[model samples]
Target: MNPFDPTVHLPDELLERIRERAPIHDRDNTFPEQDLEELRAAGYLSILVPAARGGAGLSLAQAAILQQRLASAAPATALAINMHLVWTGVAKVFSDRGVPGLEFVQDGAVAGEVFAFGISEAGNDLVLFGSDTEAAPTADGGYAFTGTKIFTSLAPVWTKLGLHGLDTTSPDAPKLVFAFVERTDAITTSDDWDTLGMRATQSRTTRLNGAVADAAHVVRRIDAGPGPDPIVFGIFSVFEILLASVYTGIARRAIDLAVHAASSRRSKKTGAAYSQDPDIRWRIADMGLAYDALPPQIAALARDVDERVDNGARWFVLLSGVKHRAITMAKHVVDQAMLVGGGGSYFSSNELSRLYRDVLAGAFHPSDPESAHATAASAWLGPLES
Candidate 1:
């Protein structure tokens, strides 16, 4: 009955340890330093790297399964670690596609270096397609990034930042340059991550005032937003799937807790458990019904990615669709769980309450509801009247 029963190499005890610390980190608004450390010790950071590269050599589907399990224990921790996995997963995608670039990413993961995703910028609805940051080319062919990156997860201890910027000074003009910048004096993490629910992510704002990436680390220079480039496809495909997995895990945890609460909480008038009530049972069944479609969908897409199955132009729609569904289902299931949990679930301290808050974050992630709808519509019905 446990969806997290898939043992994808993540130890049960390690998960429990992380789960035990989730509340404290959430309450104190601190990064899960110890959780990260334990994960590192477990070799979790390198799950996507090839075995030859000193990693577990797990496929994207396997990693997704593990991520879902991790999220169930600690959603914030799962989300924070998602940034690191994004880079590693990207590296795996490149390797599979025979792209020479991003091997350094795999190597770094094997070395236990934490890589954070820095693609987000204020007013940049394009996600990976556009960047507000300036990628000033250094005389030596590297880049000096100057701009503000919002929602930079793993802020407290990221060793390298995987980000992109606009190269306006180049002959091409406005090409998005991808590279990695090591943590340095030029990079500053703003103390401004006070948030609802997934507070433990500590995805603080990072101001890169001439944060430098050497020429060697500069990987791609491509046109941004909806391209056939492997780099773009790799990042988008891996990111959305893993992100969906995390939220799916949160949904699972919420339903499990609701089941326990519904069974134990008694109705004063009836002198019986609330679980006996048909409405409460129906709510739980509805939650399960919404949840039933997600895991298989996530797994199938992830496997398709790993197997190099081409969905043609349908890739974006498919990827975004599953992500959208997973998050929406998660939010719906959590809402149902709260209703079934009765008034006690209203308090912030309740686990169900935390799940309620955490699930709200799904709407804000990339390829949000509007974007997902647009993407899917474009795929099925063609573009709207110009």
Candidate 2:
């Protein structure tokens, strides 16, 4: 059976189309342009925007499920689109909290404006803590961002970029300036996207040469590094939860592929299917054991964010932990499938092979294992003693 199916959010036909283009995009190391177009027209870009704002107004719990479904068919497409959704989700998070700062992002989604998250930078382990990009103040009370941003997904076509930088000149020295910059001549995208996997993402390097976010569009100017700001919490909660959903979906698909492989391929000596072998059955069971615990956890935590149930100081730990678990589960399932299916699964053209490569990317996303452990340790045992 096909692992991806029509859900309340995305139609089966849409999933089929996305599935079809995924391979071609991966083969060419190109962005999933077709997938983006389909998702945009399906009103998917507006799923997290408020209903009053001309959108479906989906909860984080609901979006997580839809993302998983989408990811099962094409992890790269799901992951690239995830960047766009992050901004919309952030907008909703603020609106839900009576903060209307990101209302423009909601409005942009309704009008088919693609927003790409651009917080990642070279050598910035601080994540949102700080930015090397310069956020120079303008005479009109806006900021001009001039620095490089890496791993900028949707680089070729994003209409607006949601980014942050360090504002050192202002009296609020070192405040991280969060704003939206429209794509224009000032921004340049590098063609250096070659990678090990998830090539369809085409997350190229972006250089912002005085890319300006006007006064009206600058959203936050809070002190950088981890803080009590709602925007930071909103970004961490939504990004990590949805990220976990994507990798979890990859594992779900790998399990299905393993089951199919076992059922059809016969063992020469026994004259029976691999599925009949006790060892093969056990391997499949192991995959299920790992995959089963994630969805409910993802959904429950997502709902917690939606309902504003305060996890307080534990929020970072919870989000990071879930992300780490999802990636680990996906990689384990793919590895087992490789062994279960034997030599055929080893081919570069094999779906499981591609998945194996794509799953490796999970380790690099924010709140990585070391950071997750550090956050959890700090939450439960306090910071390290000097």
Q: What are the per-residue Cα lDDT tens digits for candidate 1 across 1-386? A: 33434454678888889999998898899999999998998899999999998999888998999999999999999999999999999899999989888989999998999999999999899889989999999999999999999999999999999999999998888799999999999999999999887999999999999999998899899986668888799889999999999999999999999999999999998999988999899999999999999999999999999999999999999999999999999999999988888888999888888888888999999989999999989998999988
lDDT of 2 by residue, 66-85 (tens): 99999999999999989999
- The lowest-lDDT stretch of 10 consecutive residues in candidate 1 is 1-10
Relative to the true structure, candidate 2 has a C-alpha RMSD (angstroms) of 2.5
Question: For candidate 1, what's the RMSD?
Answer: 2.1
Q: Which residue pairs does candidate 2 place in steric collision?
A: 129-225
Best by lDDT: 1
Give lDDT: candidate 2, residue 362. 97
Error of 1 at 262 (Å): 1.5
Q: Each candidate's TM vs. the true structure?
A: 0.97, 0.98
Cα error of candidate 1 at position 215, Å = 1.5
